[model samples]
Target: MSSYFSSADLFRIAPLVVLSFGAFCLLLMEVFIKGAWDKARTAGLFTLVAFVSLYYYRGQFFEGSTAFQGLLFTDPYTFFFAALILIGTFITRLLSDERLREEGVGAQAEYFSLLLMCSVGAMIFVAARELIVLFLGLEIMSIALYCLCGSALWSTRSSESALKYFLLGSFSSAVMLFGMSLLYGLSGTLVIPDIASALSSMPAENMGILLVAIGLMLVGFGFKIGLVPFHFWAPDVYQGSPTPITAYMACVVKAAAVAAAIRVMTLLFVHGDLFSVWSDAIWFIAAITMTIGNLSALRQRSVKRMLAYSSIAHAGYMFVAFIAPETGGLSAILFYLVTYTAMTFGAFGITMIVANSFPEKTDADDISNFNGLGFTRPMLGVLMTIFMFSLAGLPPGLAGLLGKFYLFNAAVKANFISIAVIGVLNSAISCYYYLNVLVAMYFRKGEVSPSHPVGMPMAGALGVCAAASIFLGVFPSKLYEIAAYVVTTF
Candidate 1:
């Protein structure tokens, strides 16, 4: 093989390079910054670096490239996800500023550094083509997140959340690694395309090992994406972690996992009897994931935990696209991820703002906290309503409704009508809970007094999320076309 380090390779990995560099700088700064104010300035510096990186890679969105001899690949698909993860990180930094101070999470430098490192990992995860590189990226992202989940040293829940996430995340990684080892043993290669070719040439009786490998790999991915049987850690982790970190996991982490799954499953398995062997199993998982997520969400009084379950249901909806890999399924998943990121981040941003408003209430995430928000903070109430409606997949939630429409349409086109129908019914069931929050915000009467004012940073983040959600909903054709183009490349 030719040299992996070249001008082209550097260009392909530019975004990751920039993020890692920023993270390194932040880590070094931690030793010198003794004051909370200095740490806050460092956080701002991190945000600036992230924004610069985002702009630097703006043109890559239209230029498809590959690097490191296919260990890393870039196309519209990778570009979309890389940019999405970076943007999510920037917004999270913005959201984190106030929360860190309010919650007394004093290690601002470490927190910001971990956040950037996590973005680096997520970027790598989406762009990886070889299983080894993919695993490396996954661990980089997961480890940073494990630390960030418990970064709020003042809160015991933060520590607990971090510990739970670490234990579960490590187990999943082991399962995934074992699966990768089995796959390598069977195919004698780590590159995805080579593995597919090897499997095609292998004797039919050897298929049992391949099936088992696929199952193990799914267990690993199922945990990452918060699928039903493996999603036990999500709610506790989401509720216990600092709110901004929860937003990051919900949007960026979930997006990366879905992207990786689409690449690995559709690219390698869609070609042979492999797809049929796993399609029914994936379909069943999707159905149960959706049902259980929605039903469990209904019982949660904590808004953050409720969204946690909602995130699981959304994962199931995305999995519906997986069932129909050939017929617009990839495109549907891409579009839905974009919309999901926007709505989820927006909802969390609003939640953070609401939580910040009532600093004295330890149970700020309780549904009752939002009571009569419409009467006190009318603008927040409206934004929260938009996010809730979008999540529930109702009209005027144009982005979310259209996203679901495309997913179900793809499923129907691929002749997985039952999965699509089940997904639709789950959406219906989810509305009761999503709308329940809206009712508390607008209908119920209660005194609303916020301890801190809403800063421009928080406002800006919410504005971006709301605008994206609305824009995608209203003129989805362009993005839809882009998503379709990306799928063709894959």
Candidate 2:
């Protein structure tokens, strides 16, 4: 009925287009360029393209525009996540280059290309207002990650991780798609808003089908976000995958999943009789997820595996925001997501650097590997301490502390005092293991000296992350304001 390619649509979709183009260019470089130096240059160029694209769209945060017949919505929420994913990808690429070169996989251009594609997919996933579009985005992101997880060609563990992630990810996607189909069948529409409107007018007898659809959908989202019961794959996958890829999975992937879940749940379920039906279930899941994640992390000797469990627990903390009544729930979740991204990325970056320092040894991810790092590599040691403290919700200008405080406060405001209390207890439980890392770095004695110096790229990435973690904690008002705007706009 109308022209589909308006200038407005082009403006709205520029970031996604640029990312896809960058990925394609990377692939071309891989095929055409025989020199290792050229491949590194190509990867750097791709990262620059991605950063520039995001910067060009910075105006969209204030504009709050929608385009492509409502399939894409560009607002503070979308801009927030889009920028986050792109920045994460850029940082990850920086980390990946050195690691690949060190591990003898530096010549592979496909790795960086796949990483960019994953970022594109994540951006699309967060912006989708239609179910089919959302599914496409999710699969695009997931498939790339599946390849990235197993990209360590020399390691059998990487292959195992890839296979497990692929199978489980496929099953979850199928379950979610089935749920979307059920909802479409019942509501006669694929658009989220349309489904909500249709459900409001439907008869009580259809409640059973709606319930099943919701359950299936939650199961799918739960698996993606690493919530308990659906969380069995996370530790294995995180441990088996490359450290930088693990960072991407823990931060960008989880953030996208949570953003999508919040959008869908808030649109359809948060305001009706449906809210009553599902609130308790979510509350119970949140409680158990926090407890299980914290307790499991306590027994892990491998720092990477410990942080995997820690990611699960942090997901549980984020879920606490879901149970808060409408006013503060979404904003709290968004704020916590931002803080979580910074601290988690910092932790993983530090882990990567530490692993790199121990080039002569296997199992470098073990906590004991960090022994006396405070004395040997004070900067990394201090940065890791900040990340660890933030993750534990410790005070003294740590963003994680402020994030958990806001989350728990929202829970209190919503009258979920018991759930908030359990979340607090879980935060306390998490401190022991998080602090254990710090103790190893500062107190325990190491058998050997540090093997390598921290590279400039890695150091810069860690600095940015650590600073964000602190700056956000000390002055969260601006971000909170943006989060409020995002929630109110939806």
Candidate 3:
């Protein structure tokens, strides 16, 4: 490798530089700046830098350019998801503004900085072309989140959730690192495609270690994606964390991990020789993940925990696309992720509002607290209904419905019709629990009522989400066409 750095490399990574330095500037603001609207001003700084960053991630550079002597690269695959990370982070900040005031938390600088840095890490994670660089990005994002989860020092659940995440996340990292080491040893390469190239011609004696490497890495990513059996941490973590951060985990975190998985898995499936080795394993994981996620969600009374389980099921849906990557799976996954972001934030945003309206207690998030809410808060009722309907894959909730159509269509195209049927069945199973919240809000009356006032930032954020759910559903081609083009490039 050349010791010299080219301008092309630097230009390609300029967006990340802007974001990383922007994060640093935010931390410095604590010393150099202070006053009323401090957070508002901080948010303004973040928004300014973030949009500048997005200017590049959205399309400033040609796809397929590498930075850092090929350790990181620019491509439509990277650009699309990197842009999504920025969008998700911006929305999270919008949602968090109100919560920050409500919690009256100290060290506002650290809080917003971590959120910004997490987005930086997520972008790097999705852009990385080498295993070590990928791991670096993953750790940067994971460590930021571990600390963010515990930032609410007033709550013991917050502390506990942080510890649990830190410990388990560390273990999964170890497992994944070891798997990467094994792959490196067997394939004698660290670049993912090179690793796949070397593995394709491996001697029969090394097949065992190769299989072990694949399985171990799947175990590691399964923890990150919340596949069933590896999902013990999700419901607890989601319920215990602050609501905005919970939504962050559901949207940005899941999207980044799955995008990385697609890169890794694509190398194997396209290579053909090794496709069957993991094909059956992915199928089983997808089946059980969808089944268990929906079943567990059905039992949850707390909206947060239910959404946690719902996230797991969505992971399974993405895996269905994996089964047919050659048959529009990648495009479907990209489109589904966009719709998933809109639907998820919409649901969680309203859930936060309804809970925030009542007394401050653990049970405030309970669906029973939402009784007769449709009558009292009609807007919230309508928005929440749109989100729930989308998640259930029903009509007028057309985002979820169409997202599933693309996913299952890919599966059918690949001749993997069985899993498509199973996915459809799971979709039907999910409807009961998703709609139950609507029953609580509209059909039942209870003592709970909105006692506190709210702001437009959240409403504004939710309105964007509702529009996405409806607009994207009616005119799928608008976003789907770009997603398809990006996937073709991938």
Residue 282 shift from truth in candidate 2, angstroms: 1.0
Mark the regions of model 3 whose C-alpha exceeds 4 Å error after superposition: 1-3, 56-60, 101-104, 268-270
Number of backbone-clashing residue pairs for each candidate, in the order shown: 0, 0, 0
Q: Which sections of candidate 1 miss by over 4 Å?
A: 33-64
For model 1, the local distance difference test gives: 0.86
| Candidate 2 lDDT, 1-490, residue by residue in tens | 8887677677767778877887788788667767654554566676677667667866754544677887876777788888778778777766775677554354367887788889889988898888999999999999999999988877888889999999999999999999999999999999888899999998999999999999999998899999988999999999998888999999999999999888887887777798887888899899999999999999999899999999999999999989975648788889999999989999999888787777776787888889999988888888999999889989753689999989999989989999999999998899999999989998899866656766687788889989988999999999989888777766
What RMSD, rounded to one decimal, does every model reach?
A: 1.9, 1.6, 1.7
Candidate 1: deviation at residue 341, Å?
A: 0.6
lDDT string for model 3 (157-262, tens) is 8788888989998899889999999998988889887887788788999988888888888888888888877989999999888888899999999999998888
TM-score, model 1 to reference: 0.96
Give the TM-scores of the predictions, in the order they appear: 0.96, 0.97, 0.96
Model 3 residue 239 lDDT score: 87
Worst 10 residues of 3 by lDDT: 53-62
The true-versus-predicted C-alpha distance at residue 486 of model 2, in Å, is: 1.3
